[model samples]
Target: MSWFGFGFNAFGQISGRDRDGNDGDTSIVYTPTEIKCHVDEKSEKSSELRASWSRRASLHLNGGRSLCLAGSNSPSGICDTGCTDAVVGESFVILVFPDRFESWDLDSDEKIPIWSMDVKTLCDGAGSPFNLPLIPGGYIAMTPPFYRPLSPHLKATRLALGAKHSVLLSASGAVYTWGLGSHGQLGHGSLSSEGQPKVVEALWGMRMIFVATGGWHTACISDGGDLYVWGWNESGQLGLPSRAVRKAPKYQTSEETVVTDLPTCGAQPEGEKDTQVFISIQSFPALVDITPSSELKTVGCGSRHTAAVTRAGDLYTWGWGQYGQLGYETSRSDEPYLVEFFRERQLRVVDVTCGAWNTFVSVVKKEVATS
Candidate 1:
């Protein structure tokens, strides 16, 4: 398994070291650069890249003996020999084991755990992970000392968090979103904040197998391999035309810029054929066609970009690419751009994970191994 990274690297998060083992030499990686995943043994059962604001971890599930590949200032307790999984945040890290869980504060040289939980208490109070609450029609979230009971209990199958919003996927393939909707990241057809989890009416019948959210947008892959995107299109992260990418961009210099009033409501403005509808914020889910023939297997979204791997063993990227996060050796795009580098090298992308300002992709030789 090989790893490649690109985009912001001011802190050596993408690459642990420069040519001279110095972090000051490279501030931004403008292309796909291979990064080492330090491992004691190659017996991992599965792996994932967990990213926070400034740092990232390459976590390996080695038959319950978890290992973390991290950079400077990572919590020491995260590498516990018996760890099963971990959740990395901006200021803390939570290590989960079979018997218990431990939370550690970042940059704490003392190496003391700030929070911990016994597996029995958790499974008994919350549910399986922590089943103490016993909320009849709801679920509980382990937020350290308190149990944040999420309402409705929609049989959620997966959850994706964004900068200020959250997206939940139900077992029935329905998508729900809440939180900051000023930029229309909720896919609710309106720029209104939802106090509770509200189902995205636009995708009512579609059976989505996957959902993702980051920065100011949300994306999901339908069962038919179609991609639907919504939320802020400021950087063309939705793979749609945006006024922000125009030569003479309109709007303001602050983050309060709300994008609305365009001709993208399933129709065109009565004008010329070449007329472009530059959208800033898409409050509803819009189907994005990327190579009408190929089917997308999975997708990943960064703060200002998006990436996806097709079943044909190919990678496609779009949106903000100022730091080469798009992996196509370009700065940005309003449409999906295929990354030919992997094809030329005969590599097949299997999985992808996007950080706040960077992207990491895992791949293997396109040809099957006969040895």
Candidate 2:
């Protein structure tokens, strides 16, 4: 399968080409470029194969049965292989960093991949070797022993990470988040950082099946095909009404008057009194009411923007667009505007991936019939 990348290529991560040896070149890639992979021509691309990116990129094959990592040196030894060696097996839990790599099989929780002192030299400032014990019901610190078993009642189906935050979607259709919350990205109705995963109580009773995080924002889709968003909105990335505009004179357009009658989570305030509040930072997940009423299929997020594909094969983007990442000529937006680029060509967007400051989308061209 082919890959594409954009933004931050100083380490040769985006180009997927050798960077004149180990010390990569110092150039930035502003547009999408096809990334070269070392896969054999015999291997077929399956929908089960997918990739996720942090500062580096990690490819998860067949739902974590096998894995490959790319980019500069990382804490997880996976990067040390430089995408050469693929870790194969479902019993393993892998955690990678820029300079270190760590893994553990369910049978042996103490198996440490061999590496030098750079990444494994110190842990939590005590000069402890990088060691992780994948045991159940244990206290976990940020560094070593990073993996911990969840409650018996919870079974995670997917996990996603932002720059400094994380999202977990459970098989039971529950959503949990943890990590940096300075920008109210945790969606807990408060901007407090969490060390452990916490359920987003504000979305109680709602069944969320998918979750994605941007630099400082979070987005998720409900089982009923609705979209909910919260967190940073500096550039209107959350697609919510601006704080300034909500406080201004309320001009009820004919369309707005009609949408007000719809039954949505954000339509009415909760609690003792019905006090209308102007929210600048959405500390809680609020349902986004997009027009034309369509069920959402999938969602993705960049550092400052978000994207989603609808059941009707339409693509929508919002937030920072200074680099045209939002597929629009405008610089920024707070609304989920539809992008007609692929629709005009009869191509259906099947998947999307986002980098630190770029967006990548995969489309399937519809077959034409000849009479």
**Every candidate's lDDT:** 0.73, 0.59
Cα RMSD, each candidate: 5.5, 10.4
Instruction: Indicate the residue-level lDDT of 337 in model 2.
Output: 89
Top-lDDT candidate index: 1
Off by over 4 Å in 2: 1-143, 242-279, 369-371
lDDT of 1: 0.73
What shift in Å separates residue 76 of candidate 1 from its native position after superposition? Answer: 3.8
lDDT string, candidate 2, 169-190, tens digits: 7777888889998777898877
lDDT of 1 at 33: 71
Worst 10 residues of 2 by lDDT: 256-265
Evaluated against the true structure, the overall lDDT of model 2 is 0.59
lDDT of 1 by residue, 108-161 (tens): 766667776554433332212522122223332324442244665587777777
Q: What TM-score would each prediction reach against the true structure?
A: 0.83, 0.63
Off by over 4 Å in 1: 16-25, 39-46, 75-77, 120-147, 248-264, 269-275, 368-371
Strongest candidate by TM-score = 1
